[model samples]
Target: MVDFTFNAKEQEIIREIRREGLVLRKYARYYDEHEEELPPDEFPEAKEFAHIDKMAADRGADATSPTAFYMCMLMHRTWGDMMRMKVPFTALGNASVTAAGTDEQKKRWAKTRLSMANTEPGCGSDSKAIETTAELDGDEWVLNGEKIFVTTGIRAEGSVIWATIDKSAGRGGIKAFVVMKGTPGFELVKKEKKMGIRSSDTAAFVLKNCRVPKENLLGMDPTVKKGGGGFKGLMKTFNLTRPGVAAMGIGNIMACQEFVAEEMAKEGVAVDYEAGQHKRSAIQQKMIELEAELEAATLCTLRAGWLADKGKPNNLEASVSKQKGGDISRRGAQLALEILGAMGSTHDQLVEKWFRDARITDIYEGTGEIQRLVIARELLNYTSKDLT
Candidate 1:
């Protein structure tokens, strides 16, 4: 046993997440404790994601430091607590609220709210294709469209939804709105049963004539700015949370490595030495490579996270971290399966579940493809025009 312990500040937040995570797990268990059996559809999972999301938001609503937030993530990984995703997801929402919300708006909806951006159904990668619409109606904003794959939308008391204020403006015309739940037209239609991170829930929502007060608009009105009027605003959250997502990936990497190593020992194999020196087996060599990859992935993710802590804008670094972490996760799952042979494929062992869950990290947030594009853009000095 690692017997991991945190420093004072870290411990405080860790305790908070652990306590809250327990509450969340109990709640989730009520509906379905069998995380492996949930359907990855769109409705119920969304609702489940929503519930955990709220609890996480509440945990951090009063924290004074970002390090505390980071500690929450570490505690989650250490405990193998998937419900801690809510902490980062909620932090993402808070970033947006802090950047764009009015004082009053922040007070009412943001103090403990969970907001989301990135990942849509048709175009999770392309922010330009967001079909959600927000039209100014008198003193209220009327929203209409469907958002599929909202991580915490199912249970969030409110959300800061991104929508296009001007269709002709394209990405430039998009704006964020702080919409409340049960606002007449906002409906959580489904929840998803995910492959990994089974404890966390994902959702799809429909907005039909969902009316929110005009004061809920994030950033200035679209007509007041040019070129994705609020993109810069939304980017704030991404910059802050993406590294944390990379951290989550790192956690998964560490988990797989630990599990594999432990299992290998039980099978009468010492994983610390090269395969050839012992059994001289090709399978052993493959396992060695998997362990090495896990190490590299862990370092990459930690490096990016450390940079963020240093007050640096490390978008490229963050993308690299996530890309490497995602790759390592996939490879780790494959290697674990091979180590266990036939039994590895069984969901009863959790290796299979981890493998399935690892796939989502590459697809969500900015996707592996998007991360590559981002890295290329940064290295090549490419302007926004080069994105297409």
Candidate 2:
């Protein structure tokens, strides 16, 4: 039941995604150097990639699980750039909407690109400590807050803003609302200059007495439960995305591995599968080790998916996969650069850019340290850590 292999159809689809991703790869450095420019909504070369969701892949009884298949799809999609695609991806909040939004809420914004406004100037990992507030007046809810480091904030037609209705109620008071771009007081304040992934826009927004119909509220429930049930439901979206983030790193490193292998081949450093350690060069051994490490992380990602497909909770495993992914991607990219020496550091090669990109894998979605804490708490059976 925990098999790590992809079926024929699943493998074919993933291969297609990676092949199409090459078009995006060609532009990775152009946008990396030109951080102010956002990638086009669609690349003429890889237009078919934008419709990959429409591909009909019928798996036989031996097909891969839905969760695993989705992870692979996301993984290969980012084989070129971390989050950049030939097409702009629907913001992550879309996943939150699909998971926690009410039926009417889902229908209302089925195709809207909705950014997530969660992190604030003072809050990053501690989401519950958000200072944003939501006050109801009449049939509208007034919002006041500043959300920073929003991905795709500039391009999203709207955003899902998080504000606490009753700060004292803690997590239960935190709620999600759909706020359109031209809302009375919602404004895009900043488009951050990030260290990497410059192809995608990371924005900051300020909401001043912004009001939307109360029905815009996700879950459409105002009663704040003591256990923060509604808030937890939205957080589950992270469990789904953490591994996805990891898979992106995995996909990137796979590209790195290919690049490195090709470079080595050019230098007559051919990798011999049958060669013993005594016969192989140190760099060759390192390449093999990197492959093993990548394989290990890849398996962790699939395991998280496997757990989900089995209808089991994967909170702990998600963190494990993400931690492994972030670690290896950072390590793998750095090692690739080191092996290439000065050329690796030059803009002439994407390996240097990937090295910069690898740093973020550990920082976003949840830091590698936070993931460790999650794993520690799960193993010890301790109560949830006080993230607030």
Candidate 3:
């Protein structure tokens, strides 16, 4: 029942997309080196490919698997370059809003690209410790907080800011609100200097008595429910994106392998599958191991994405894929550099950049430790409190 390969229509579209991706790959290094400058919203070459989507009108139902194919495409994107070429890149907040927002809130901000504002100066891995506060006053909700490491923070039309309505209520008091960028009392503090993914903007913000209509509250109800309130409802958005983060790792993995393999090929080294270990050189042995790891991690990602497409719970699977993808890509890039030696670290090649870029895929969606904890709790049927 599981098909690993895409249908023919999907295949056709993927090929064309990759064809264009190769063109963008030319600018990867340019953006990587100039981390301070955000990639242009639209490349001048975009005009040539403007009709790419409409060209897919005749695709069959076999190509309709959205989440699964999307994972495949994410890998393809990273394979081309870590610096993305898409204009007006989609924001992480958009997914959260779709998952937890009131129907009216969704309709109101249908076109707004929203970045997620969850991390605070003090809060990184443990989202439950968020210090941002939200209070309802008359027709508006007053929000006061500082957000850091906000992805797409500079380019997002708005942000889905998370704040606790009552810290005493614990996680139950946390909720999300839609705050437009130009809203009074909302200030862009500064952009972050990063080791990788520089083309994508990361920024910080300060909200001092920032007020938005009370209706902008996601999920509409702010009374700290018996549980962590709307906190769990908002966190559920990661069920799909965790696999997405893994897919990014998969892309880097594929790139790392290909780069090393090509370098080996130039030196007249071809990987021989049938050879015994004793006959294989040390480099050949490592190549085989890297290939095996890449295959395993990719399978884990595909399974997680497929589960999402089926409307099934993928919490355990998502964490598994995320950890696998994160670990492999990080290691693979390092191994690739080791194989290439001095030339690898030099800006002459991209392996060094991959080493830097591959790091975040694991850390952001959730740390490796968090993923392992999720896996443990799921296996033991333990709630958060029980596991902690």
Candidate 4:
């Protein structure tokens, strides 16, 4: 029930990003018409905060609320949708450095944004089931396997890959590594033509005997005989990034609400705008519910981010927020599309794209099913090893 009070500066920042969103929307249409118009990188101011250490410190020092930091990142990413395919990789890379990388690793990757190409073919949702192998060879680790559905894999300056060091040990055996671009055996094998968020790149990577250094190991925890370290570190990254994904869902919901409201207005629908009186249009009613749900989900996301920033555990809340946000996003988009009728199906209207974009929210970060599983696991006092 808590509301975020955006001061004048924050309000201006939000308005600027929304205005920028309009520009990105135009470019999205351009990309739809001419695929080549999509660029590998379209620089945005968000890149300036790509360094997690400083950004984290600044947030802490300024006594800025976690809600503000999350909001800033959300706005930055949303505006970066001008080059969606590129920004995701940058964000992923930035996240990896903060969550898993060593001080040295962080410094080295500080300047360049990297993408996480973790999921692979047949891997489904189990990151521990990854087939990518990283075998120690003298001073270096040799990696070999194919990574599928890597967001930004095609154009990443570098990648943080989650692969198994020992398949026999299962999930615990997984480890993450920082793989720089142009590593001899690391190649972008394919890029998926996505249904929505077309501007964002989704790619597959083929690592054939790719050599990465021992120094590239990310987890601060030392590997144990019980297969510790890797997946735990990856989960930390997820805890932080998943909320950002949820925020994206919230953004999609906001877009849907806006579309639905406009459509209702065009039809000469009128509803009370008073503080206590609820709106009456079917679509408007749905929007109101979605907005309330989004507000709650947004709070969860901000709390998760706050916990992460404070180094507190928040597995349950994070999953709940993601699940709620993703579900609301899909529903809000569906409602918007239904209100728009046939026009919703057309590419000319952004509602169709919003619906498509909302679907990805449910699938990525963690599937709604996966989020439920995680929530239940946490509620039941289950450990990572128990479910995996």
Which is the leading candidate under lDDT?
Answer: 3
List model 2 lDDT by residue over 1-388, tens digit each: 5776777777777777877877777888778988998778877676566456665356668877778877777777777777564654577788789868999888878899998888998988878898999999999999998999887899999998888999999888999998999988999989899888788789999899898999988989887868888889888878888998899888888878888999999999977779998999889998998999999998899889888879899999999999999999889998898778888888888888888887888988888888898888877887564431
Q: Write one digit per residue (lDDT tens) for candidate 1, span 297-367.
A: 65565556566666777778778877876676677667777777877776456556656666766776787
Candidate 3 C-alpha lDDT tens digits along 221-318: 96887777588788787887888889888887788899889999999999998999999999999999999998888888888888888988889999
Q: Sort every candidate by lDDT, greatest first.
A: 3, 2, 4, 1
What tens digits encode model 4's per-residue C-alpha lDDT throughout 66-145? 64466555834453342343344355857877877888778878877688877788686877678999888988989999
Lowest lDDT sum, 10 consecutive residues, model 3, at 50-59
After superposition, the stretches of candidate 1 with alpha carbons farther than 4 Å from their true spots are 1-91, 102-107, 117-121, 220-224, 272-284
Ranking 2 against 3 by lDDT, winner: 3
Evaluate residue 6 in candidate 3 and report its C-alpha lDDT on the 0 to 100 scale: 74
Candidate 1 vs candidate 4, TM-score winner: 4
Ranking by TM-score: 3, 2, 4, 1
Task: Judge candidate 4 against the unseen true structure and give its global Cα lDDT, from 0 to 1.
Answer: 0.71
Candidate 4 local Cα displacement, residue 322, angstroms? 1.3
lDDT of prediction 2: 0.84
How accurate locally is residue 189 in candidate 2, as Cα lDDT from 0 to 100? 84
